[model samples]
Target: MHRLFLCEKPSQAKDIAKVLGANRRGDGCWLGSDVTVTWCIGHLLETAPPDAYDPRYKRWVLADLPIVPEHWKMRVKAKTASQFKAVKRLLGEARELVIATDADREGEMIARELVEHCRYRGPIQRLWLSALDDTSIRKALAALKPGAETFSLYHSALGRSRADWLIGMNMSRLFTLLGRQSGYQGVLPVGRVQTPTLRLVVDRDRSIADFVPVAYWAIEVALLADGSSFNAQWRVPEDACDEQGRCLNPALAQQAAAAIGNAASARVVKLRTERMGEAPPLPFDLGTLQEVCSKKLGLGAQETLDIAQALYETHKLITYPRSDCGYLPLSQHGEAPAILQALGRGDPGLAELLPHLDAQRRSRAWNDGKVSAHHGIIPTAAALSLDRLVGKQRAVYALIRARYLAQFLPNHEYDRSQADFTCAGQALRAVGKVIVESGWRRALPEALTPGKGRETQPAQPLPALREGQDCAVAGVTLKDLWTQPPKPFTEGDLIKAMKNVAKLVDDPRLKQKLKDTTGIGTEATRAGIIQGLLDRGYLRKQGKALAATPAAFSLIDAVPRAIADPGTTAIWEQALDMVQSGEMSLEEFVGKQSAWMSKQVQRCVSLRISISAPASPAAAAPWKKKRKTAPRKASASKGSAAGKRAAKPTSRT
Candidate 1:
């Protein structure tokens, strides 16, 4: 009798099969002499929908507002049921079973669900590994743990799932009913993560809408000399006044600009030079990778994530893709040399820096304690063969590979100089930077264009000078500028905001509490969370920026404050982490979450929602009647084909 092994996805199953000598492949399972490997397309089992428990729920009704179940039931998804059955048969016949899903909460839940649904009573073991590399897989197989060892993780996953269901089901129904009553046609979708994310978009929109710009002025000075001319900016002293002493007078700026214009030439008053060094950026986590890709390449959060996933699961050039921690384990120290060597093979620039790759220099960011289930995303020893990757995967892989190679290079060193000149009565200053050492920036494509403003500028170098030194001014001209409002959030900026939510809040204690909590949703879930808001029509994309819909704003206004606040999610995350760390009981956490959901549901039901009716008579009908109109078929034309391709796959745990 063979030991049956379960993996998360086919790519992972293939890697595990190759390592376990399970070469005889079937539809979804691989047969070996001692072990048979099988895989699931994410989730094979899921919480049963309301309709599954009661026929009345087939048609959503306001009367059936809160469909709370005594015990949530699990159902095998119809699409993957046949594959699940085959796995169940194998498990029943096998002498032992091994779980080899991804090393995370969802992975643990997948194994638990398979065991629960199949009723497999055989001895069970778990194959826990961070990456799909042969060495990692082999080691994991050698020391597989008893399935019970991860019961806590399974419990936590179950708690999260149940909590989401309770809140999602109750609130979704409550809002949908209320929305219809108020004459809204669109589905008022809600979720644990989706609602909070929508609230963020709504809050941001509110801020931008209510923003009041104030008039401010700055004085500009121009100097003329050789072909090179430079400009200087200064603010009028607060004590300075117009003809009248009142500081509020706008004419004071004109007076200052005129006074500076009258000066013949500026004399050197002070000069300062400073040397600075900038370290290479830390390794990419999923959120960081998404942010950078979105900002630099105009990829959506989901698009970037999908590309990163392919790079990890298909290309095998990166570690686990959906990682939150930006740190690697100490054991991975020896692997850096091989990674650098592989990177140098594909990128010509990296070849020059191979000798400088520090095998002994351990980064504090690469600490094992900082890493939880998965390490930071880094390029594997796999050579970059662009031919193997199609569209977005190629782009994402290039980013990961480039970032990994960059870390192995030296720091950027530069000299910055600032000179203050007194021209007649006005003071003017000139700033310049000179690169002393290109360092890691040498690998950057835009490093040479210092002060260009298109890309990040290299540090400036200052010349040595004294107040008495007479340096010829190149030239100068007045430059006009306008004060602009805060820019809207791109997908990248939004991801960064979500990751650093603590910084956005003004309260120090709350900020610290948020820090103590999980920074944001797990990497595996963040993109989906963003997508959910979009699907719900709570958030819309406007030229790569997220803008809140009117309905979303109103919903946030109607909802309880706790539901809209990131701090609440932060607190729950903290408690969940405590459960995971064995610091708090799973029962305690679940009990509290269940109670909170109950309270939130009650609050949602009691809250008054006043939706403005559409101007058209047909559209202005009560929500109940409007909801009967079939939901618009999600058009394949609206989104990329990749999104459509993903829809066919079975949901994963």
Candidate 2:
């Protein structure tokens, strides 16, 4: 063959091969005159385990604490070994090769590792593709990059893999052995990313356990003016209030409630009104999409990712779904009219919105400077019909489309008014909000819009009144309540926490490094990382909430703080970015990781480890096999007065 195309998966290969006119199918490949196309099933090979280096490393022992490999090795994954052989055969037959994998670091590693392993010496080129649609593919084919340009991405990916192996192989063995010595039979798996994520949950659970409820009081007064009524809250004096401005003295609140109840009217002391405008939110990156899906659709992180991937790959309904950046490239703006026109044609439901959309309008989301490896997830002109999509797929597609449509609409405008009143020698405040224009909010689904949930009160509009106007007192209600503990992490909340973990760090430098790197895991890998923790029994689910198991708590307490610190992981990521930019070599980066791994092993070897064991081996295993039926939604039980009052009536008013 004169040319060969190497793709990441069979579906991707099929799509590209059709465009290349490689119609005939060969064994694990497609055949064309003087050209061929072949694919790998994800990664054809994985990093060799420790046992592959030496037979002696099979048994877990403290003496072999740090197992550093002088020469790294790659072993063909047994499951896909046959496919690997076919690719190797195709590589040897081709005169020239093209890499057409996913456009990211991990994808680069998947293809480059094979090229090096197969010893293919030929003219090489790279295919930078974002979408699998015909137009996108053909455009990319016309402008293939030289192999040397993306060589750094392969090195960066290699550095990440080697660092992960260094930590996963050495530290996991070190901890498992220590836990065994302390009479814990369960295996303890530690990772550079997963461990830090587990730490977040463990810390949150502990905070909830250690929290003490403090009693506080609040009074709500209803006032009437010209037959219209509004609610006002009692303002506590500075001396008798807490840091949050909650009233601390029960006697003072009771006295104020009674006085307000007996009073005839309240004089408005001060009034102010201001116009506010909120710009449309940026489009969904992977992390933000997963968070919104979990909150609005009750879907898990992995579940949301699966749906998004299907939309991109199978349905051809959206652009690449694994992007971390939410901003669109300015160059892509020219295609908006075509895509918007396609949406209107495919779905008649969107016909009404078509006239309102101004394809020429550009929002802040269209910025070339902020575009990263890929742009935000958006709909493609490839979509021909929305009727083919069902259930969660349709719901997710609606969300993505709404965000795109929002960019063409004006800002959501409103008027906010605040009024201060004096009644029975006590200070009171009333706040009201009125919408001047629905604007971008018109594109949002009612369920996804603001004020849909019971937790968030609906906006109230107050009657027009002068500063010195006296409003008649309608009624007064005093409430006694207790502060609530922090809620457990949902998958969505955990995803958000992972993205913004720098806020929890103490050191300024480390914190900034984390913020710059966008926290512990990349957008592409975070869902898988979280799923691994769930599969390993490190985290448990209580309804929609997530809590760390006892084994998880034990592991967190036993490990070195640096191993569990998200900031430390962020520093490692910063170094990887340096590797990608050619500021550091792969050898130097792996060397530092090895040295650090050795120190961690040495420091923990002499220490005693204690772990909280579960009642049985089966109990400690992941909660996957026997699925727990979802609990019925209800209010707090009769015993928890504090829980029942978690939603304060005064806040609702």
Candidate 3:
């Protein structure tokens, strides 16, 4: 009997077919003597809608909820139903099956659900491979594990899916009902991940709204020699300033400024010079890529993610798209040379630096221990093919290519020098620096340009002199500056915040726990989670920044404080990690989540939402109850005004 292969999507199926020598492609499948290949469009089957259980669930009504099913039913999605039926028939005839979905929780769910829904009783094996290359696929096909071995992963995926449904469906309906009861027509949306993300926006807005700027003063001293001038900004001693830097009293800054102003000349007290080495940056993960793209190129999180996905899936120019770790495995060291060679061939600028590439001496960013699930984003052997992409895709691919080429170069080194002078017994200082080596920065030299208010001063190496070097006081200028409030969250800033949620917590142990965990969500899901908020109208993008909607902020306020805080999600992530590692039971982790979902559902039901009524005619109707009218009789007078009335609310449960 032939082995049947199930792939996640049609593109993957085609790729695998090419690699497996199943080149004879049929309508919905490819067949070879050794294997038969078929594909799924992400998910061919999903949990049935509430209306599927009973006709009464066709309309929205609070009385029909908490629509809990005894055993959740599954149905084929209409668009893909025919293809699914074909796969189901193939599965029935095959003696063995191979699950060849992507290597992740959701991917595993897709495969498992297909097997269950299709009642595939044949012996099954899993095709787990990271890359879609010929070698990777061959090796995976050679050592497929029994389907039973992945049961735990399936259970975890199931728990996640059920929990999301329980919370999202019930809470959304509850809020919608509450809104309608209050004369609002807008949909009140809610989700497990989206709500907490929305809270981040709302909290930041609150902080910005309540921010008050206070006046502060700083003193600067200028020293001159040979018509060259350097200035140093002043800072109050730690003991002189209050805890909040109110300066203990404003008089202190006034006195210090006056003392410096009264001096005729200052004596050179001390001078120090230091050399510093700046290491190359860690490799780019999805979050870091999204962040840098947003800051540098003004790309949104979703935009960056899509680009990365295309670079991985379409261009084959990067490794797996969704990765949290910014480090590569030690085993991946040997492959660097080939990747660099490929990059050099694609870009002439990079080809010039090929001589300096060091494959043997590994950077700290390439450690194996730091990597989990997937390694840092790196260029594959695929050359840059800009002709294959347009718009955002091209921009994102360019970023990944630039970052990957930067890793193999040398470190950026600079020398820092300080000059000191004293006037009227007061000490003054100035700092100057020069680049020692452009290093990796040579790849992206424009990044080193100083911003506004920053002046490039000559190195000014001091002539060998003792402490008594006489220096003339240059013309002094007082510069006034006001304190600024914190900047708003851009997509990049938000990704950084999510990855480093530990910094937001006060407790050291708790902070460490969050750090040890991956923080709120995996790199793969974070962008999608953020987009879900935008799509649901819980958050809005104003230019490049994210701000919470009123309904979003209100929902966050109404929910339990812990649920709204990232700290809580951080803690849950820590627990989830423990479960994955077998330190904690899956049952325990899921039990806690279920309880949390129930509580959130109750909270949503109890909370009040005040929203303006929707202007659309379809949204203005009141809740209605079904009548004992026959469909034949109702249709006979369909054109009549009475017959055109909307259907009554149905019982989903």
Candidate 4:
């Protein structure tokens, strides 16, 4: 073939091939007139294991703790070796090549690694696509960017990969050896990102375990105004309340409750009413989608990602599923009319919503400056009947669709009223809310609506009353409650925590760095990281709550503080960003990382670790065991310390 299009996966290759009219299938590729499309099943090659450099290094020893490679090697993954051979052959024949991969650093690495491995030096270009629909494919094809434009992304990815390998290979061996010295038989796998992520859960579990609930009291008074009933809460005096305004003194609460009950009426001392307007929420970024799905549908983070991936790759219903940006590109707003029309035709349930939608009306979600490589996950013009989707998939699709529809609706408006009352020398406060306009809220599906817990109480339209008006005191309730401990991280909550880790850091400079980069792992890899922890027995799920296992606590305590500190990892991430921006060379970044790794190994050589034995031999250790001839499947794949596919290196942070 004179022209070649290389893709990240078989599904992606097929989509591009269909658009290019490359129907005739060749070995491991599709072919059309002078054009061929081929794919890699994730990375066809992985970073060579430490043993690949020197056989002696295969044996874990402290003396060989930090094995920094002078020359990194890439080996074809055994499972996909055949595909690699096919791609290599195609590269040899093609005159010009197009890199058609997912539009991200990981995707860039997947295609670039193969080009370097196969030694293809040809005129090259990049097909940056956010969606696989025919129109998207054509648009990208017409505007192919020169390969040099994205060459820096490959270097950035390589830096992240080598850094992960440096840490994973050295620290895992060092810790596993230390664990053995302490009579702990299981492997202690430490990651650049997973280690810190595990630390987050471990820290949360500790806080929950160490929490001490304090008793508190609250009083609610029911009041009647012109035969309408509403509730007002007792406002405790500053001296009798805590910082959160909760009454800590039981005697004070009882006295207030009795006074309110005895008083026949409460005089309104102050009344204030204001209208509030809330703009529609931005569309789903992968992290936000995962968070909402975990909270609403009780799905795991990885599960949500899988569903979204299917929607994008299989159903072709949404744009890129792994986007970090939640804002739509201003250019995309012009396509809203077509997408809205498609939605109305595809789902009969949306027929009622169609009338309310104003396609020309743009919301704050459309901002070119805020959009990144990929825009928000939203429905494409290729919408189909919703009946074809079931359960979680349908639910998630509805959420994406609802958010898009909301952008064309007016703001949700409401009137909030606060009334301060005096009853028997005690202060009382009543808050009331009345919906002035349902607006964007009307477009949300029932599943997306606020739950009863979030509602707290039904909206009560306050009766019209002057500041000095008196309302009858109907009844009083005294509540004896205890301050609750922190709730365990659900998969969704953990995702949010991972993205917003800057808030957890104490150092302002480091916190700002974390914010500059994505918090812990990339949006594409966080779910995988969390899943990896659960798979390794470090995190156990109790219903929807994620609790750290005993082994997790031991590992966190045993590791160097910097290894488990999210801020340190986030700083590494900032360095990687510098590499991407061409501020730092890859060689310099790797050298610094190697020196750092050596120091970490040297410092922990003599320390002993205390960890509980694994519940089972299989789950105990993925590293070496004294008596066993073979170790169980590795806690993680080789070089994937982040608990994700190494081909697409997750930011070690």
The global C-alpha lDDT for each of the candidates, from Candidate 1 onward, is 0.69, 0.85, 0.69, 0.87
- TM-score attained by model 2: 0.93
| Cα-based lDDT at residue 346, candidate 2 | 87
**After best superposition, candidate 1 residue 605: deviation in angstroms?**
2.7
Clashes of 2: 0
Backbone collisions counted per model: 19, 0, 5, 0
Residues 1-653, model 4: lDDT tens digits:
79999999899999999999999999999999999999999989999999999999878888877898999999999999999999999999999999998899999999999999999999999999988888878988999999999998899899999999999989988998999898876677789999999989887777666666677888888999988989988888998889988998888888888888999999999999999888998999999999999998899999999999999999999999999999998889889999999999999987787888999998999999999778999999999999899998998999999988999999999998989999999999888998998889988866676443533446678888789999999999898877776677899999998888998999987776677777887899899999988877777776787867667777888999999998888788878888988999999999999999999999999997898654235457454343644423323211122212211312211
Q: Write the per-residue lDDT of candidate 2 for residues 1-653, one digit (tens) a residue.
A: 89999999999899899999999999899988887999999999999988999999988888977999999999999999999999999999999999998888988999999999999999999999878888888989999999888989999999999999899888888887888888776667789899999899888777766666788988888999999999998999899999988997888999999999999999999999999888888888999999999889988899999999988878778888889989999988999999889888889998777778889999999999999888999888887788888999999999998998898888889998889999999999998889998888888976786442321225689999889999999999898877777777889999988888888899987776677776878888889988878766667666677767766777899999999998888788889999999999999999999999999999998778887653224434432364554422222212122322332333322
Q: lDDT tens digits, residues 1-653, model 3? A: 38888998888888788878888876578888778899999889887877888888778887666766557788889999888987888888789998888776677888888888878888888887666655556766788878877656665566566656666677677777887777776565566656666677676766666555555555677765655666664556678755654343456666776777776656666777678776777778889888888887788888888888777776676777777778888877777787777777776656567787776657777787787766777777667645666777766776666666567777778777776776655556667776888776665547522233433343444433347766666545444434455566788888888888888777787877777766766687788888766655555566787765555555676556766678777776666556555676766766677677666666566556566332222223323343443322111111111111221222211
Segments of candidate 4 deviating more than 4 angstroms? 450-458, 615-617, 623-653
Residues 76-189 of candidate 1 have per-residue lDDT tens digits of: 889998888877787788888888888888899998888888887888788877666676567677888888887678877877787788777777778767877777664555
| Winning model by TM-score | 4
Comparing 1 and 2 by TM-score, which wins?
A: 2
Give the TM-scores of the predictions, in the order they appear.
0.86, 0.93, 0.84, 0.94
Instruction: Provide the lDDT at 91 for model 2.
Output: 96
What's the true lDDT of residue 416 in model 1?
A: 72
- Lowest summed lDDT window (length 10), candidate 3: 633-642
